[model samples]
Target: MLRSLCTPSLRLICKPTTRCRLYSTPAVPKKPNHALGVQNVKPWSELSTPQKVVVASKTTVNVGVILAGVALTGTIVYYIGSELFGSDSATSVFSDAVDKIRKHEELVAILGEPVKGHGEPSRNSRRRNRRITSQVVEDANNEPHMFMRFYVEGPENQGTVMLEMIKNEQKKWEYKQLYVDVPGQGLPSKRIYIERK
Candidate 1:
């Protein structure tokens, strides 16, 4: 019985079986033809009238917008510069007032020599570039008047300076009032008359 079982199992194990197909093999990819795949771009002269017009209009609009933006930026900068740093602006008035204060015998004596003037003080360092407090308004006589205030400091003490000016018949700035107020200095704050109207 053992010989019979072994002989049959050995014959089945050693026998060759015919191959059967289940799935087909994938086809190889063809080489790309660069010359056939390339696209032909038309020249400017070959473009249609509508295409040329569209391109031209797009370029014109882009250039116009750029020029307009530049012009606007320049106008804004010029206006702001004239308003802030021009010879006839509020900043000019502030400079003149500070110069007068530096020369005044009373103020110089109280605040000490080499006095410096600046705008309002702030706790934040970035806000130190404060603008001068100023205003331009018309008076009852329809004459334009400018009012300004700023701070001044010296080796001895710090004080606040206030001033007012009017545009005269010649359109020139004329000082009406200028003064410095020093608190805790034990003296009356005297109004320094720069030029009496």
Candidate 2:
């Protein structure tokens, strides 16, 4: 038993004289050689003419789609930039402001009043001294408008003015509201609105 254990390979074979040749299993088939490291090898047989034509057509279609997409994107970008930054859009608000003043009859009536051109605006002197100055100019729309600068001369005064445009049934313009520019705070800019005392 010790001898048999010592020579397990011999015991596994049918006979020692046979040298395990008769009992040995068949060798495994050799793996086919793969060219993992080789380069420039044909990966597949050449495509048939019809297959080639199909591939070419697909490539052409893909390129055309890509180009069309690029063109469309460029066009959209151009349109957005032009509309947003164009002079017309930039000037529209200023023009609208002027147009509102010019078209509104009430606004004209208010601003047209004869205050001494050099005199400060009528405001309380105790709370805060106020100096109101105005100038007329044409806006982008070529409409007459007024630019006002106000200085608050006292500590207690604050003011602001609300300016808006209102059109009548006939589309005639009017200034809709008036408010205060803070006394002596920010630079005052108001569309002139005058009320008869």
Best by TM-score: 1
Candidate 2 lDDT over residue span 94-138, tens digit each: 334444434545434434422111125555656433344444456
Best by lDDT: 1
Model 1: pairs clashing at backbone N, Cα or C within 3 Å: none
TM-score of 2: 0.30
lDDT of each: 0.79, 0.44
TM-score per candidate: 0.70, 0.30
Q: Stretches of candidate 2 above 4 Å error?
A: 1-45, 90-190, 193-197
Query: 1-197 in candidate 1: lDDT tens per residue?
Result: 11111331232222135433233345557665678986555798999999899888999999999999999999999999997898798777888888888888778877888999999887788775777899889978888988888998899988888888888778988888887878666776545554455
